[model samples]
Target: MLLPFHRQQLLRITLVPLTLLLASVAIAQSAPSVIGTRAVLTTWSDPIEALGTLSADESVTLSATVTEIVADINFRDGEQVEEGQLLIRLEDGEEQAQLRASQALREERRNASNRASQLQERNLAARADVEDSQSRLRQADADIQAIEAQLANYQIKAPFSGRVGFRNISIGALVTPGMELVTLDKLDVMQLDFSVPEMYLGRLTPGLTLNTTTAAYFDEVFSGEIATLGTRIDPITRSVSVRAELDNADGRLRPGMLMEVTIQQRVRDTIVIPEAAIEPSGDRHFVMLIKQSDETTRLAQQEVEIGERRQGDVEIVEGLAAGDLVVFHGLQLARDGLAVRLIGIADDETDIRALLEADR
Candidate 1:
C-alpha cells in the first residue's frame, strides 16, 4: 500500500479524468438539433438574359411619287389607314383634262373604224382606207390608256393597313418625288432584336419561348418566341443576332422601346440541396452529412463540388448523390463524428423556399 500523500495524489488524478469524461457525455447529450434535407434529383435550367429593342413587325415611310402641288389631304396625322386607302391627291387638273380629251378622241376613232368596216363589207370603201381607220383607232385607245396611267400617279394611297405617323405635307404644299408624307407601322406583332454569345449558337433555334420587360411597363412581362436567327455570327463581338416575335394585340408595346429579355433552353436533371447546408471553408465547400448508425444518427463532414445555384438550392456536381440527407440548419453546432438529433426534414412540404425568401 502507498502512503497517505501518495494515495491522495493518485485519487486526484483519477477523479479529474472521470469528471472530464462525464462532462463530455453531458455536452453530447445536450447538443442542439438541426434541420436536414435529402439531396433530390430535380430539373434545372440555365437561363440566358440580354438587352434588346422592340420594333414593329412592318414599317415604312410614305412619300410622294411625283413633283406636284398637293390639292387634297384625306388622312389626319397619326391615324390608322387601310390598304389602298386614298391618302393624298396632288394637282391633277392638267392630267384629268388630257385624259378626258384623249377618251373623246378614242370614241370618235372607234366610230370611224366601225363605219369603215361597214363600207368595206359593202365594197363602198377601199381595203387600204379601212385598214388605215382601224390603225388610227388603236393609236387613240393607247393614248387614252397612257393618260389614265399618268393621272393615277398624282394620287397617293396607303400600300398596307397600319398606323400612320405625322404628315409633313399639307394641302397646297408643293411636294417633290420622295418627299416625306408620313410613316406607317404594323403594330399587331412586335419584334424584339437581341444578341447572344456565339457559344450559344448551337442551342439557338426557332420557336424557343422567351420573356421580356421594358421600362415603360415595368410590372408587365411580355412573352415571345424565337422567330429568326442571323446567318452569320458577328466577328467583332463574337455574338449572334436573334429576333423574337411578340403579339401586341393590346398595342402596349411600341417600336424602338428598350427591353430586357430572358431565354431558357432546356431543363436538366441534377442533384440539389438547400444552400444553407453548405459550409464553405477557404476554396473548398463542405456539408454536414447525416449518417445513421445502429441506434443513433451522427454527422460526417463531406466535401462537395458545387455547380449552378438558383433560388435557395445549390447543385451538387460531385461528391453527393440523390437521397443523401444533409444538415441545413445549426451547421455551426455540428462536429465531425458527433451524434446529433434531427428536428425536421426540409422537403417539398417544408416551405423551405418561403424561408429563404423571407431571409432575403
Candidate 2:
C-alpha cells in the first residue's frame, strides 16, 4: 500500500516538469512555417482573340450537265481522283453511232480528195473537182468534231485532283441537268476565315502570323499566315472579314471546323509572382510579402494590382518588384508583422504537392 501511494506522488511531481519542457519546445517553434517564392520578370504580350472557321484549300460539288440515264460510275465514295479523271458516264449510244458514221464519211471523202488531187496533177481532172472534194472532206471533219463535243456532255470528269464524296446516283437512274452528284475537296492546305473589328484594321495585314485552336485537337496549335483582308467593313456590325492559310499536310483539319484564333500584339516586360500568394479581401487583393529587417524576417500585408493570371503564376501590375519574395503557402496561419520561418522555396520545376507533404 505504501508503494502505490509513492508511485502516485512521483507521477504528480514529474507531470509539471514534463509540461514545462513541452511548452518551451513549442514556443521555440511558434514562428509560422511558410513556403515562399521570388517574383520574376518575364515578357508578356496582349494577344488578340477571335473566332474563325476552317475550309479546304479547294472545294467543289460535281453535278450532272445533261438529262440522261446514268450509265457508269467511274469513281467510288471517298476516293482520291486525279485531274480530268472520268467520274461518271451517261448513256450516249446515239451520239456514239453518229460519231462512227461521221468518221466513215470523213475517210471516204479523204480518199476522194486524194484521188482528185492526183488526177488534177496529171491534167485529167478539173481544179473545180479537186476543190469540191477538199470541201467535202473538211465538212466531214467538222461534223466529227461537233459530234465528239456533244458526246462530252454525257460524261462527268473531275475538274481537279482531290478526294470525292458520296456517290449519289446508281446505274440506270435518270438524272436531270444541274443535279448535284457529289462533292470534291483538295485538303493539302486549309483556309481559315475570321472577322475583326474595323478599329483593329491598322494592326492587321497580309503575312501576319496567327495561331488557331479547335475542340477536336485541343492540345495542338495550328499556325498560319494572313492571306487576304476584307476590302470593305460591314456597315451594320463594324467588322471586317479576314482570311488565312494553314498547311494541312497531315489532312487532319477538315472543312467547316470552328476555331479560336490568337494574334500577338504589344509585348512588355512585367513582374510576375505565384498566384497562390494572393489573398482576397472583399474586392481587393493582397499578399504576405516577406520582409527582412536586421536579422529577423517578418511578413507584411502588401497591396497589389494584378493584371492577368497564368499557369500557377500571375502578373503583378504594381506594389511588387522583381526579386521580391512572398509567402505562397501556409497563408491560413500567416499574420502581418509576425516572424516567419522559411521552410522551403517553391521552385517552378518542383511539384507543389510534394513540397506540402514534405513540410507536414
Candidate 3:
C-alpha cells in the first residue's frame, strides 16, 4: 500500500477526471426529451349522434297455415336452414291415403282412355264412347292435382335461408292456423333504424356513411350507410325515421340489439393538433413549438387562432403551417426559449415512456 498522503493525492487525481466525465454526460442530456407533434391537414366533419336498434335484413315468424298435430320437427334451436327446407310436418295420414287412391284411379282411367282412343283410330269404337273415356281421364288428373295441393298445406317449409329461432312446439303438439312456432332471420346483413330530429331534415340523404357501436362489443365500431329516409316526420316526436344497413357477415350483431350511432357530414379540410398542446392565457391560446436551427433545437411560444374543437383535437386556423412541430406531451416544460430534444412523434398510438427509451 502507498502512504496516506500519496494515496490522497492519487485519489484526488482520479476523482477529478471521473467528475469531469460525468459532468460532460449531464451537459449532453441537459435538453429534455419530449414527444413532438406536427400540424396535419385533415378532413373535418360535423358529427351527429343518435340511438338506434339493429335488426336482421330479412326476418319472419314461422307459423303453420292449417290446424293439425305436429308430426315431425326437422330443425333444432338456432339451426341454419336453407330456402324451401322442410321444418315441420303435420299429421298427413288422411292426405297420404287420398293421394295414393287418386294416383291409382288416374292410372286406370288413363289406360281406359288409351284403349278407347286406339279403337277410335281404327274406326271400331263410337265417337261418344271415346270422348267419354277421354273426359274421365281428364277428371282423374284434376282430382289428383287437387289432393296434392291439399297435402302441401300440411307441411311447413322455410321461405328463405337463415337461422331458425327457438323451438316453440315439440313433436305431437297440436298447432292451429297461424299459430306462432318459431322465427327465422338472415343475419349476414343487418339493418339499423333510428330517428333524427326534423331540424336536420335538410341534410338527410341516402348513402351518407355512419358509424355505430353496441354495448355488447364496446370496442368495435361498425360502419354502415344510409339506406332510406321516412317520407313524413312523426307528429308526436318531431323526428324522422332513418334506416341504415351494415354488413354483419360475422353474425356478431343480432336483431333487436341497441346501438349508438354517429353520422359525419359537411366535410371540410383543416389543420389540427392535439388539445393537450394548447396553453390558455386569459383570452389567448398559445402553443410550444419546436424550432430547429442547424444542429440546435429550441422551444418557441406561438399564439394561434383556433377554430372548432372536437374530441381530442383542436383546429388551428392561423399562426401554424403544415409540418410545423409542436410539443404535445411534457407540457410542464412550458418555459419559452427552453431547449428540448425531439425524441419521437407523440401520435395517439405511441406511449410516451417508450418514445423516451427508444430515443435514449
Candidate 4:
C-alpha cells in the first residue's frame, strides 16, 4: 500500500511536465513559418551548349603506285615521318636492267648520229639519212627516260610530314597499286567535326570561337575556331555539319577523341528565378506568387513558360514579370490564396552548387 502511494506521486509529477511540453509545442508551431522565395525580379542571361569530337584536319592512307615485292621498310609503325622520308622500298629487279639496256641503246644511237653528222658535213650522206639517224637518237633518249622513271617508282617516299600508322606490308609481300601501305595523320593541328541542330543553324558561322573538352584530358580545354559549315542541312536530322580547327602544337590533342563543345549564342535580358520556384505538372507549369499584407501574407498561382536553364537559374519566358515575389520554399505546405505573415522575405538565393558540394 505504501509503494502504490509513491508511484502515484511520481505519475502526477510526470503528467504535469509532459502537458506543459505539448502545450509549448502547439503554441510555437502556430507562431510563425519558414518560407523561401526567388524574388523573380533578378536579371537573367541564357547560353547554348553543344558537343563535338576531335579529329586530324588532314588524314590519308598511303599506297604504292605499282605492283612489286616489298624489299625494305625504312619507317617503323607509329613513327613520326618527315616530308620526303623514305617509307618503303620494292624490288627494282627488271626495271633496273631495262634502264641500263635503254642507256646502252641511247649511246649506240648517239655514236651513229655523230657519224652521220660528219658524213653530212663532208657531203657524203643524204639529208634523209642524217635526219633518220637524228630521229633514232631522239627515240633512244626517250626510252631511257621512261625506264628511269619506272625504276624510281620502286622506292616509296612520304608525301607529307605526319605520324605513320601500323605497318600493313612485310618484306617479300606482293602488293599492287592502290593497296594501303600505311595511314598518315597530320596531328600537329587537329580538326573537330560535329553537328548542330537546325535551330542553331542561323547562329553557326565560320570564325566562331568554341571551347572543347574531352574525357581523356579532363583538366585541359582545347580552343578552336569554326572552319567550315555545311551548305545544306540534312533532311533526316535537321542538322548541319560544322568543322573547327584547333592548334595542337604540344601534340596533346589527338584524332578520334570524343569531346564536348560549347558555343555561346546571342544574349537576352530577362527575369531569372530559381528552378525550385516553378511547379511542373504534366503539361503545365506554374509558380506560387506571394502577395503583400498589412500584418499577414497572401499567395497566388501563376502559369509560366521557362526558357534556357543554367547553373540552377531559369529564365522566365512568360507569365512571371520583374519584381514578382516567387515562392521557392515551403511550397508543399502552401496553397492558392493562403493568408500568411511576411515575417520577412527568406534569403532564397542560396547557391544550389554550394549545397551540392556539402552533400558530396
* Candidate topping lDDT: 3
Name the 10 consecutive residues with the lowest summed lDDT in model 1: 351-360
- The regions of model 1 sitting more than 4 angstroms off are 1-43, 268-271, 274-276, 279-286, 290-298, 302-306, 310-313, 317-325, 328-334, 339-360
lDDT of 2 by residue, 1-360 (tens): 456888989988999999998986775488878889899899986677899999888999988878899999999898999999999999999999999999999999999999999999999999999999999999999999999999999988988988898988899999998899889999889999999889999998898889899999999999999999999999999999999999998888989999999987666899988788999898789999888777567899999999987677888999999999999888998899988877788876867787777766
In model 3, the Cα lDDT at residue 137 comes to 89
Please identify model 2 stretches exceeding 4 Å from their true place.
Answer: 1-37, 266-270, 274-289, 298-322, 326-360
Name the top TM-score candidate.
1
Per residue, candidate 1 scores C-alpha lDDT tens digits across 193-295 of: 9999999989878999998999998999999999999998899999999999999998888999999998987768999998989999998999999998776
Task: Report lDDT (CA) for all predictions.
Answer: 0.89, 0.90, 0.91, 0.80
Residue 157 in candidate 4, Cα distance off native in Å = 1.4
lDDT for 227 (candidate 3) = 98
1-360 per-residue lDDT for model 4 (tens digits)? 456888999999999999998986765456334354554555443344677777886788988899999999999888999989988999998888888888899899999999999999999999889999999999999998888888778988888899999999899999999999999888999988888888988787899888888888899988888899989899999989999899998887888888898875555578888787778989888888887766456788888988877887778888977777867756776678776543334454566445434433
- Give the TM-score (vs. native) of candidate 2: 0.73
As for TM-score, the candidate ahead, 1 or 2, is 1
- Model 2: worst 10 consecutive residues (lDDT sum): 23-32
lDDT computed for candidate 3: 0.91
Which candidate, 1 or 4, has the higher TM-score?
A: 1
What is the clash count of model 3? 0
